[model samples]
Every structure is written in structure tokens, then in C-alpha cells.
Target: MTNFSHRRVKTGSDPRRLADYAALRNELAKLSHPARPDVNWQSVEKRCDALFEQNGVELQSAAWYTLARTHLAGLSGLNEGLSLLETLITHQWDALWPQPVAVRMEILCSLSQRMQQLLRTFSPSDSDYSALNLAEQQLTRLISALQRRELTPLSPLNALLSLIHHSAVRLEKSNSAAAPVVENDPEVVLTSTGISAAPSPETTRSANEVKWIYLVPPEPQLATNPQIPPPAAATLWQPFALGMLAMLVLGSVALWSWSLFQRPDPLQTPLASSLSALPSVLSPMQLETLRQQGPLSDALFTATQQQLTRLSQLPPDWATDYSRQLVKQAQLLWPEKSRQLTQQWQQQVNAAALPADTMNGWHQGMTELQTLADKLNALDEKRGRYLTVSELKSAVFSMMTHFRQTIPVEEQLRLIRQLPDDSPARQQQIEQAGQHLRAQAYALMKEKEKETTAASF
Candidate 1:
């Protein structure tokens, strides 16, 4: 029974040694790989030569290099040499593996001490920051080398590495714990097998297989039914809509240009008279368009302003009568109820008129129109009687007749000043106004009386 137990123990022990041997051989192959570009042979050789010459250890070039660094790290009172030892340990793990456990432990202890020592040497201005980074990289490599050789799987060495790793974890935990709680929700749960519930089927694929798994969903396949033709692709109607919008824009531009340039004949009596009279309450754009179309009309309107005076000068009944006459004329020329009447008038003028006579008449009509326009404007500006309800009807008709015409100021101003000042309530303010019909009438009456006295003399 004793012999069997001993045999069992030996069997268990044998495989562990074999495992160590196999792992070490693999690590050696990795360290010695020709393609392993990280290992620097010359610097390592130089370091080993210096150490071996001092220590009197006889070894081959590579073996001496490996053993020399391992000794430098394992020795006491060599604090500055730790960096050199760290580099050697990373590149020469194969050599270290053949050493006894005591030696390996001593080397690891030295490495850990060296790591702590390096933290103090961290200078922001140091050109050797890359070397330091390389040093850290080597430390990582050494730890991995140990693992490859089953060194980290052992109790004491494993515990030491774990202690270092855990310290880093604790430091990170302390910092994160100091932060205020940002998330009210817990982390997403994973399955028992470490998969998230919504784990991508492709996530488990090997690196080489990853390319085959598209992040985007695949296009859907059509049904295999023979009877149905494939549904027609949705037609893009954008071109048609754009074409229609373009046509509308062009039409509007053409209309605007025609209206702006078109002029009226001034010789035609009713048309000329209508053109002569315009309201003060026209919008600036509208007024500008009309002025461009018929410059003669504007001149006539100005002359009329110089002639006519305030409505208050007229008999109260006469003011109403004049308003009715103007309204009736406006309806005949530019009727609001029927646009056809205005169109018919235009057609008649086109049919009967000679081009030169029409042109000459238009010029004269525009001049008279401008005169009357100025008079109407002066009346409209005053605070006294000017337009009544009947006159407003007349003005609307005039605006429609001269659709090409614009109010002489801002559109908002024309709207605001639509009601004329010759109203009864506004009579008190009539004297403040200049060039009104009443004022003109009073002057005329005084002149007539003076003429009678002269004749008597």
C-alpha cells in the first residue's frame, strides 16, 4: 500500500515536471524565433559581456547574455541595474526557466522591486519615455513568459503577480468610487456562459470568420411565386414637380416685366381721364411699376394737384355728387363686379386705335392723369374731407384698371391711409392742408369779385 501511494505521487509529480519542460521548450522557441523582431541581440550581448567579465561566469554568447541579466536582477544592492535586468528577463525567459525555483523567485522579487523603483524615475521631459514604455512592455512580456512556463500557476509566484494586479484594480476602484453615481440603472446582464442575452451570432466567430458576418442586415429575398410579376419600383415624381415649378416662376417673371413696361394712350378721353386720376394711398412698389409704365400719367397727376383744392370749398351736396360721378366713371372703366367690362374696353381700344395716334393720346392722357393724380394725393394727405365710401369704390376700380400701377409708398402705408381726410369730422383740420378744392374755390370766388369791381371802375 505504501509503495502504491508513493508510485501515485511520483506519477502526479512527473507530469508536472513534463508540463514545465514542454512549456519552457515552447517559450525558448518563441524567444529564439528569427522573426521575433522585438529582441535586441547586440545590446543584450554587450550587457552580458560586461556582467560575465565582472562575475567570471563562463557561458556561450547567448546563454551568457541570458544568465548575466538574470543574475543582475537576482543580486542585492543593484538598484540601478534593475532596468537592465527587466529587459533581460523579457527576452531571456527561456534561460531563466532552467534555473532553480529559488533563483526564479529571487529574480521575480527583484523585478517587482524594480517596477516600483521605475515609478520615481518617471520624468515628463525624459527622452527615454519610449524606453520606459518598452521597459513596461518587457515587464508584461516577462509575466507572460512566466505564465508560459507554468511559473505563475504556482502558489507563491501566482500570489505575487495577483497581488500586483489586484493593487491596480483597487486603485482604479477607489477613483471610480469617488465619482458621483451617474447611472441609476445596473449594467446589462449576461448569460451564465458569459454571453449577453442579445449577443450577436457573429460575435462568437473567429477573427478570420468575422468578415463573412455583415453588420448590416442582408437584402430581403423576393417570394418564389411564378404568377406575380415583381412589383414596379416606386416612381420618383420629383422631375415633373420641378419642371412645373420652373414654368410657374418663368410665367410670373414674364407677367411682371410686361406690366411694368406697358403704357396707356392719353388721347382716349375716358381712358386718359382715368389714367390721370390715381390715389395717394398706393404702395411704393405698385406706384413705381406704374411710373415706369406711364411716365406721362405721373406728370399729368402732378399738374392736377397744383390746380385742385380742398373738398370743403365745394357745396356739401356737391361733394357727394362729385364722389358719385367719380365712382360711376370708375365702375364703367374698371368695374369690380365684372372683369370682362375692363377687358372689353381694352379690346375696343386695341381694335379702333391707330398706333401713332394711340401713342400720342397715351402721352397726353398720362400728362393729365399725372396732374389729377397729384391733386388726389394732396387731398388724401390732408386731415379734412377727401374720399368718401363712394370715392373708395372709385379708387378700387382705378387700382384694378391700372393693375400695372403701384401705390406710391409702402403697401402697409397705402392700407393705413385708405380713408381720405375730406370727412365731416376732419373739416376742422382742412386749413392745415394745402392745395385743396375748397381753398382753390375760395380763391376763384375772390378773383371773380375783384374782376367785377374793376369792370365797374
Candidate 2:
């Protein structure tokens, strides 16, 4: 495939261009060690796009490469970055990048490494086999091209070959595996069709009952007709019992007649109270403060951003209003930074044209973030207070429910990425956690959908 950058003939050899490239590279490097990849990646992406529009072929290629790496760096995931990387370098690196062969080798090596990292992030069951195959094809092509250049098998080339072999083996193993992997869900489960509860044992068991062995004596069950057998005890109560039975029959008939005319009340659904629903907005400083609290805070931040990003399909007016509301609230909280943020945001809004999705999910996401903050605050308040076991259990269960509701798969992957890069254990953990979250979310959503459908009737 032809390199898109080769269509332009602009030489980016000027001193100023080189300086800009240096700055751009500096930005790209940050993604590799990003403290706030969610927040920072967008800006880097925008900058690269702008540079690509205004710069020469070499610079544009460089920009495209950087943009691709941003995805590799967690802007998206492996497929996107891999697609971009493959598109950029097919047969035009010399025209696209216009650098030394050594630099070319380095860039390709980095791409291979990133692909390796991305591959490691998936399990056999949930892996993107298509992506692996694509990467394998691309690696083969690149390695062959390098060979045609009469280049010896260097470390980078070897790495590419290694990944290709790994992909083949993986694909083979996946195809040859006879046993289907069933999701282990214990009692309540995500089945092939949907969520379901496993049946109790009693219905399927034999008629013979098993005796219970108890250290403490079990409570004896009462005989239903104990008083009827003892004539002395029964005789005096019989008249009273007959009177009571007559009264009960009359009351039951009257109640049944009343019920025939009464209507059943509709169930009231609980309102989902979120922080975004609050009267106030969170400032950037406050968001930073959230990040400072610890990993859960970081996860909360990450998860909120993710859910908020999904809300990006909102109406432009709604998005604008939501963002401005945030700006106004931040102004109330921190006048200094809010002014700058407001100006920047407005400029962006205007540039994109008003009534467009300007800040999708900011408001709703803030509410979710705020909801988490409130919950954490409540928990914090309990410090030094003696919490009963029941109270502790309720709190734990509530927090877990909120966590699962708030935190998405992305945050877990992000957290995993934050660990040291050289551990097989970390890779396995990421794959497990990611798959579990996805399956759990899918099951719950499907179950909720069924509930909604049933409730409508």
C-alpha cells in the first residue's frame, strides 16, 4: 500500500521543523509514562492532527506515527494502533519518515514491542484473533522487505519474527482446543443465553430425607392436630375455636369482596442518584484532589472518564450546557484556573461550531464522580467509630455494588499497565480481570434488559 505521506513533497529538514519534532516527541514520550493518560492523551492527539495538517511529508508521517503510538500508548487499544502502524509503513517509510535506516529500525522495533504488549493483554478465550493474524501478516511483510534490502536479521527483525511465530502458535492452539471454556459463575451465573440462578438441590433429590447432625438440638416441629387428640384440653376451647373460625370465614369473605374492587399499586423504581445530578460542579483542582486520595480514587477517575466518554453522542446544546455548567461551578470553586479553562473551552466550542457535542459526558461523568466522592466521604467519616459486623457488611456490599457500577474494564487495564512491564503474572491478571468485568457487565445488562421488558408488560 502507498504511504499517504508520500503524496506530499515537502522537505521537513529545516531547523524549525526539527525543533517542533523534538517537542512533539517529548509529548509522545509522556504517554509511555502517563500519569493521566485519559486526560492528557486527547491533547496529544489534537496536536498531532494539527501538525499533520500544517507540516511537510516527513513531519506529517512523523505526526501520523505519533498519533498511532498514542493509541498504542492507551489512546485506544491494539487493533487501532496496529491498523495505523501497518498503514503508515507498508512500503513507504523512506518517503514518509525520511530518516536514516537505523531510526527506521528503531521505530519498527517499538511497534513490534507495543504489539507484543497488546497481545499479552488478552486471554485465549477473549483474544482478538483477527488482530493477531493482521499483526502477523504485517510483521511478515515488513521482515521480507527488510530482507530484500539485504539487511541482516537484526534484533528488531528477530523480534518481529518472534511475534509472528507466537501468533501462529496461539492461533493453532485456539483452533485445536477441543474443550470449550465455560465461564465459572458458581450459584448465580451468566449462561449462554443470559443470567440465571442455579436450581436448589431439594427438587432434584430423592424422596428420602437426609438427617441433620447438629451439635445443638434442633427445634422440634409441632404436630398440627395436637389439641384435637387430648379431649380434656380440646373440649373447653372447641366452642371458642368454632366462634373464631366463624368470624375468620366471615372476615375472609368480606376481604375477598373488597379486594375485587381494589387496584394494585405500581412499584416505584428507585432514582439513580449521581454526583453529576448535584447542584454543584467539580473543579479541575478538585479532580486532582480526587487523584491524590489513592488508587481507588485514580480508578474512580478513570472509570468516570470512560463512562463519560460513552456519553459523547449527546446533543450539542446539551453537551455545551453541561460543560458550561461545569465551568461555572469550577469558577465558584477556583476562580484562577476556571477563567482560563472557560476561555479555552469556549474557543474550542466555537471552533467546533455551537450546538455540537462539545463536551460529551462531562456533566453525567462529574455526577458519577461526585457520587463516588460522597460515598467515600461517608466511609471516611466512620473512621474511629465502632462499626458493627452487619454495618461493615452493608458498607462493603454497597461499596462493591458502586464500584462495579462505576469502574469499567479500561480502568483495570490502566491500573495493570501501571505495574512493572516485565511480569507474565501482570499480563495474566489483566486478561482475567478484563474478561471477568466484560462478562459480568454483559450478564447484568442482559438481565436488566429482561427485567425492563417484563416490567413494561
Candidate 3:
């Protein structure tokens, strides 16, 4: 939506190219929904291939393509999904510092989700269980990789791993209850097919042998410290030392006097100059309050304008990071602003003074605001928040349902699209608000149906 053509730049194999790769990944994700029969897979593939050509097939591109392919293949119920996941897992392990650990974690989560989906479609006895088992193993390895790399494990990844472990346990329990017992020779190696069982003596021996080789004790080495003789103290050097000490003391006094005279006067420095700069650190409550204000309010609008002005004056590196923080803060404030706008519109609707077109514009604006708020809330959830994305999305969807009960879709779209793009925050708000409207439109349809039934009765 942000016109990738204007943003695109030809660059060599550098980490900065990851931005382009992420853009492609997002586009592919939008087109990869399984239930959307309207999506053209051939066109999606062609677009993806064109990106691959533009960037060249590097490890990062391979990762992006494999993830995109996994999603597409998964939708079609092709075994290629599982194969692509396996390839990704292998690539993650084999490559030297493959992609960012976060990207790897996402791939692992995707694989886990695909495997879980597959398990639902196939019978317990189907070989697809093996794929699930492999996915579980890969997740275990991914957890180890996170630990080994000393990276903090993402909350979602941990949740997914816990889920997979629980599912595997449940599957094992169910399989064991239905499985027939088959005793084998004591010497014969017995391995678990799908259910957990006692290992045979041969299997135990093999495992212990590997551990024994790696865990062997090493001989302790003696500890020693190097000793250097101190230099001899001589009266012959005393005269030089005394002269140097005298010079040092005199120089120190002179330097201190000069510094005192040269220091800037604290009273002359304006307090406004210091206060104009953004604080280096904000407290959590302060951050929350800043995030809850509506962008339409004069206070917030002026503050954001000032912040943007300050941002431009900052160094390039500082500006980049600060801009991201500003965007996130703006996003968080959207929901509260949306709710406020809705209330204002409702009051105007009862007044009967506003024209029909004016009332419609208010409704459209509120709808767009609420939609963007939901997405921002979803992004916040990804930052390890307690509220789940599903819950927030559901609530926003309910609000949209209420909106649609009063306004038509075509009018809403037109009004929302016509929203002023005077600032980056306004532009982003308009774009994300329109992007997910249709998906959330029916989220609360069943609830509406229930209410209708009750009312009719």
C-alpha cells in the first residue's frame, strides 16, 4: 500500500535488503489465505518469482520463498508443504547464522501450525502423524537453538512449543489406549512409532554410548600465576619524581581555574530548550497515557507535530528509531480515539441538524478508526502482552458489526479512503483501516443473528 516502487532500491547482499524481503513476505501472506478461493495462485507465484529475480536466490530469499510456498501448499493440501517446512528446518540448522533468529522462530511456528492442521485432516493411523512428530522434533531443536544463541525466546514460540508438547502427549495417550501390546525380544531395539514406550536394551546402549563419549571427564590442570619483580626504589630518581609531582600539582590547579571560568552559566540556559526535547526514557504509565490519546485532538495533534519537528532535527540514526516509537505510540492511541469519535457521531445522529452526507462521513471515519485500532492492538499483543490477538480482533469485529448495521459498505469505503493524509500517522491509519474491513465484517454475524432471533421471539 505504501508504494513499494518508490521505496525499492537495488542493493548488494546486505542485511538492509531484509526490508524488501519482509515486504514481499507480507504481500505473499496477504495472498496466501486458504479459504479465499478468489486468490490467484499462479499470479502470486509469478509475482514471487519476480521478487526472487530482483533480489537473487540468497538464503534470506530462500527462507521467504519457502515460508510463502509452505502457506500456499498448505492451503491446497499438498505434501509439498511438509517438504518445504523440512527444507526450511534443515536450512536453518545448516547455514552459518542463517537469518535473524526471529525469522527462524516464525518459520518453526508456521511449520508447527501446518502440522497441527494436517493432523486434524488425517486419521491417527495415517503417516501424517510422522510429519507431526517431525515438526515436534524441529520445535525442540528450535528451542535449543534459541537457548544456544542466548536469545530471549518469544512468548508465542514458547506457547506454540507447549501446545505441540501437550498435543503430542494427548495423541500418545489416545494411541496407547487403543494400541495392542506386542512384546519383542530383550536384545531387539524397540523404538516408539507414535507413542512413548520403554526403550530396548540395545537402544539404551546406543544412547549411553554417545553420552559417554561426549561426557568423559578431562584431567585437571595446575593453576599458576606469573610473578614480576617490583622495580627497585632509588634515591637517584627522587629528584626527578619530586620535580614532576610539583609540575603536576601546579598544572592541575591552573586547569581547574580555567575550567571554572570557561563553564557555561546554568542560569543563562533556557529551561524551554531542555523541555522541548523528548525525554530519553518514558515511564510505563506515561507511555500508556500518551498512547491512549486520539490523534484528532488538538493536544495530541500538536504534540505529534512537535515530535515530528524534533525528529527531523535529530541525527539520522536517532530519527529512525524515534520515528518507529512515535508510530507505535500513535497506533496504540487509535482505539480510544475511535471510541470517542463513535460517541460523538451517535450524539450528532440524534440531533438531526447535521446533513445526511455529514453524518455518513462521521460513521465512515469511526469505522476506519476502529479497524486500525484493532490491527494496532494485534501488533501490541505480539509484543508479549497479556491480551491475545484473537480477543482484540473479535472485539473490534463486533464494533464493526455495529457500524455496518447503520452504514452501507460502498459508502463506508469511499469515506474512509477519502480521509486526510496530512501526516504519516494519518496515512497509516487510513491504509490499515481499509485493509481488514471485509475480514472482520462477519466476525460478529452469529451474535447479531442470536440477538435477532431473541428480538423476533
Best model number under lDDT = 2
Tens-place lDDT digits, model 3, residues 159-185: 656755665566666676555434232
Error of 3 at 260 (Å): 53
> Where is the poorest 10-residue window by lDDT in model 2?
209-218
Best by TM-score: 2
C-alpha root-mean-square deviation, each candidate: 32.3, 43.3, 33.0
TM-score of each: 0.18, 0.29, 0.26
C-alpha local distance difference test of each model: 0.41, 0.51, 0.47
RMSD of 3: 33.0
- With candidate 1 superimposed using the best TM-score fit, by how many Å does residue 226's alpha carbon deviate from the native? 62
Across 1-457, the per-residue lDDT of candidate 2 in tens digits comes to: 1112212112233223555456666765665774834335445544544444456334334434434543433322333333333334443445555467766666666656654564455454323344445445544655666677766435765675586568657766867764443322212223233222221221121233121110111245687877555446646788899999999999999999899877454431221231235345679999799779865647767878987896686542454455656777778778987888889976755444312232233444556567656766787778764547786576556555555544454776787888888888788876566444444443455579899999999
Preferred candidate (lDDT higher): 1 or 2: 2
Q: Kindly provide the TM-score of model 2 when superposed on the true structure, using C-alpha atoms.
A: 0.29
